[model samples]
Target: MPRININLSHQIVKKFGLAEVDDFGTSPEFYFASSVNLPKNSAFANSMKSEVEKYSFRPTLHAPFMHLNLGSESKEIAETTRKELQWAIDTAAFLRADIIVVHPGYTALPEKKTIEHTGWLDNALPNLDFIAKYSEDKGIKLAFENIFDRDPFSLLLIKEAIGTSNIGFCFDTGHYNIFAPLDMQDWLEALDGHIYEFHVHDNDSTGDQHLPIGEGNIDFTSLQNYLVSKEISELPVVTFENKTLDFVKQSLSRIREWEFLKT
Candidate 1:
């Protein structure tokens, strides 16, 4: 079966706190709910993590995206990011989990230093080094995700520099919806053995609407074909990162009943 996971956002947990919404069937990919409780205090986060433990589903945690950036330009911001990620790492360890999905940061300022992308790389590589060593010491596998428009070489280089058995890539389908330089198939092929997991969601291409499968324009069939070609279908675990509960439930149902995997 294709491993289906749910992105556990804080919003859903808040609803759970109010009145538990029972999950009747299995949620394939237990995508940790970073979108919902991203701004909560450590105590609150721990509480949510406890709730996650209550579920019978298997989980993969995504580090929070707010107030931190792994790919920050400023050294101070970068160090702060290191600390923030460490918090998530510690949380995962406490939760007795193995997988942690993380984003690759980006630079957006026009007036920022023209370090030529490679120069920007010089400053960021050290941060990746710190994370690689830290995750190793903790005995955790940190899956660095591939996001679009962010420097591609930077991600590849970081993967090379932070050489460890615990590190690999978490390919997000929506992010690939916008991947530059290489086409999506080529990109998927390049990361074949290196891909540790996936953030599965669909978008309209114009915007990241996080639509459930078959509702949006993402060609999941084609994507599945590539996964089969790579022999990834066996250990498949895809976290539906959509926000709507209805959509999340629908995504779970469709993936469980997906025709792509049936044949």
Candidate 2:
């Protein structure tokens, strides 16, 4: 069985009534720590590293997404974004993370200077290639996650252009529900073998609710069946992106029940 994980930030631990990182009992099989929770400084990362190691929890990283666009047409902004992402990659490596999740750069198409969605390929490819090499050198994988993408075809184009084993896909369920024009199966079939992680959350088509699994319209049974048939060779990391510990626990229980019912 693929290990289930939860997204944890400093705020989440605090909300759980825990005063310190160690105070929170380590029951989660894995954790996806937000880059904001992990600053780009060594001291902070090192401090948390001890607590994580003590629990024997495998870790992965969610790179800072806000304003960190690898596809920015402006050279200066793109360069800055690249550096910031590099820091994230380095920090992930420092923590011995198995993989780092990132957003596929977005574009406002029909811009006066840029080449629609394809323009993202310009800056995004080179920077992704750079990070791919960096991750490979550190023995970690980099998974580009989807957000606001209308379809998977554009992502396929980017994936094909890169064509590196170091780079993989991180499918976000809530993002697909709210932002994608197509269904989850369409996206799954498009990136079948390359999926390394699943940001498992729920939302209605109208908004990104981040609700517990099985609460909204997404059919996890269908998703699981597809994965069993298509991606059985690899056990992709599945991280619940619910906001609170209560919701996260509920989502995990829901998944467990679903798995049990399937059996």
Candidate 3:
């Protein structure tokens, strides 16, 4: 059976408090949405850590992704990206998190003719290599997530280039539904051994609605069947990305009915 988790941002916890998280009945995949939230010594970090310890919840982490590009051509930007990612890994270590998710730092450009010509991967490789090594040293795994990717090729190339056991993929269902030219089965097959987690949510195929599981057009039944067909003894961690408690509850109820998940 898969371990279930919910996405809880630092901003949300700070604004609302952690008490409500108990109602979700799952471990949290804490999102440090900004570089400012990655400092390990901050009062907020300490307080959050204490609360997590008290609850005895095993956690995963989502690293800061806004305005940060691991593939930036500018040397200064690359350095800053590395620093921020290192801070994320350090914070994850402090929180005793096993997996920290990050974006692939790829944004499709209209002028770029090919994936290689886009220059994102070439520029990002060194930084990715550094971070993957750092995460491994800290006993933390890095899950590179799909954002604007039209297919799984880029992520596959990244996994091969980095060539590290600590690095894997986090398949974002909403992004796949929005941006992918290929089907979910293609993605699962291409990324077979590389997938470590899932950022699961629903979308209308027109936008990233982050709706409850059955509220959108995504076929969750097919996904569940694929996992079962593979006979995967252990399933990837499923992190609900629904933005509201009600939506999350709805999604949870829906997933609970899938017999494969109940095992």
Best by lDDT: 3
Query: What Cα-based lDDT does every candidate model obtain?
Result: 0.64, 0.69, 0.83
- Per-residue CA lDDT of model 1 for 1-263, tens digit only, reads 55566676555555554123335344422334343444445666676556556764455677765566665667787887777677777766665656788875664423322324436556667777787778888887888777654334445666777667778878777876754435667766666667777788888777777888777777776567665565544454566777676887777777766555675
Candidate 1 yields a Cα-based lDDT of 0.64
Candidate 3 residue pairs in backbone clash: none
Off by over 4 Å in 3: 109-114, 229-233
Poorest stretch of ten by lDDT in candidate 2: 17-26
Choose 1 or 3, whichever is better by TM-score. 3
- Candidate with more favorable, higher TM-score: 1 or 2: 2
lDDT of model 2 at residue 98? 81
Positional deviation of 77 in candidate 2, in angstroms? 1.7
List TM-score per model, in order: 0.80, 0.84, 0.93
- Candidate 2 lDDT, tens digit per residue, 1-263? 56566677655543452223233322232232334565656565565666567766677877766666787777786777787677777877776678888876675333222323466777677787787777788888878888777677666666677656777889989888876667778888888888888999897768888899878998766578765664345878888888777787678677776552254
Query: Model 2 off-target regions past 4 Å?
Result: 13-43, 108-117, 230-233, 260-263
Give the least accurate 10-residue stretch of model 3, judged by summed lDDT: 108-117
Ranking, lDDT, top scorer first: 3, 2, 1
For candidate 3, write residues 137-213 as lDDT tens digits.
99998988988888777777778788779889999999999988788888888888777899999998999899989
